[model samples]
Target: MSQNGAGVDLETSLGYLLKEASSALRAAMEEVLRPLGMSVTHYSCLELLAQRPGLSNSELARGAFVTRQSMNVLLQALERDGYVTRPAKAPVGKALPTRLTPSGRRSLGAATAAVRSVEVRMLAGMTETEQAGAFRILRSMIRSLNDGDGNA
Candidate 1:
């Protein structure tokens, strides 16, 4: 409820709607990824490595929206499973740069297709113009929210 006498209306709350949409998208992605034995974060890490090889664990964690510890754990499992590889020692700094193995690339290919299908389905009803407009709107909203100072 809001501070007013009346409570906040869920039906008309854009934040609530956006969160619901995000949850639905995640569920759909998980459904498709489950058969491939990958979670959304797992797939995200692989995809990030494929696009930008040699990303550090911290970078991968930020890209995948996971914690550093969580990313380190996943990287360990991926190395064990032959999906990714990292140097025995960091070449320069404390950051162990990670990269995708051949096996990881193959796995990412399948996951990419599955994730793309989910996105296509989500945008099925929207025309190209509407899709572009929605993209711009969403980006603007994100920028607006992120522009705030930490004092808030």
Candidate 2:
């Protein structure tokens, strides 16, 4: 309960703090990516493709935390810009596997560097041990929430 016993106290809430941190991180990433003509989602898609080529639109959407429709639109733009390509027809199913073109790989290199700088800046104050501990804690939190059984 809050100090007034009414609801959550934003001043002392970990959830609120986490959200603020996420917002700050996103803002920092946007600032860096804007000059490269990329949004976080755009960068995410390219990174996903680089790591796991031949991912379907749905898979890319899930990985990037965007809707399938939004991913499709982004894919269309990427295809038109020669950053990615999809076959004229699905070889196995309705899902057309997408792959990054050479151009996409080149663009991803710059975005990766810019994103890395933001991450490096974000972690400047934390020690290696602290960073590792934070990573474990965050992973545990995600697992607990995903489990949905109050078994953290």
Candidate 3:
């Protein structure tokens, strides 16, 4: 924000706004997850794996919006923690699919519930239709950003 007309400056770009929102939401999530002995990244990955079991490393990376190297490291750590297990489907280098162990599935269920609880609390004042509208607006923003044409 600045002394300008709209009170938004370069620092208030849409990317910055989204990042700030993410930070706030993540803070709330971390508060809820701390008692469960899980970090936000761990919880997110577990949830994603639960939704798409046996997703390949590359697919998981893209879905997680991270690099393959980072995904591999996270997978290794989760495997060590018995949260996820990777059975060798083929040669490791090309495309190795990973599956969630039973423990991983359980963790995902718990984390998903916890996240939804937090989200509901955060959206308490909003009606269902308002919630839907907010989500739709966010999705449209993301689509427009990714499209880069701004035609819509």
Q: Rate the local accuracy (lDDT) of all candidates.
A: 0.93, 0.95, 0.82
- Can you write out model 2's per-residue Cα lDDT over 33-97, one digit (the tens) per residue? 99999999999999999999999999999999899999999999999999999999999979999
Query: How many steric overlaps does candidate 2 have?
Result: 0
Which predicted model would earn the best lDDT?
2
TM-score of every prediction relative to native = 0.91, 0.92, 0.82
Model 3 lDDT on a 0 to 1 scale: 0.82
For candidate 1, the per-residue lDDT at 91 reads 97
Extract clashing residue pairs from model 2. Answer: none
> How many Å off is the CA of 57 in candidate 2?
0.7
Which residue ranges in model 3 land beyond 4 Å of their true spot?
5-16, 89-93, 149-152
lDDT of 2: 0.95
The TM-score ranking, best first, is 2, 1, 3
RMSD of each: 2.5, 2.7, 3.5
Top candidate when judged by TM-score against the true structure: 2
What is the TM-score (0 to 1) of candidate 1? Answer: 0.91
| Lowest-sum lDDT 10-residue window in model 2 | 1-10
Global local distance difference test of model 1: 0.93
Q: For model 2, how big is the CA root-mean-square deviation?
A: 2.7
| Candidate 1 weakest lDDT stretch, 10 residues | 1-10
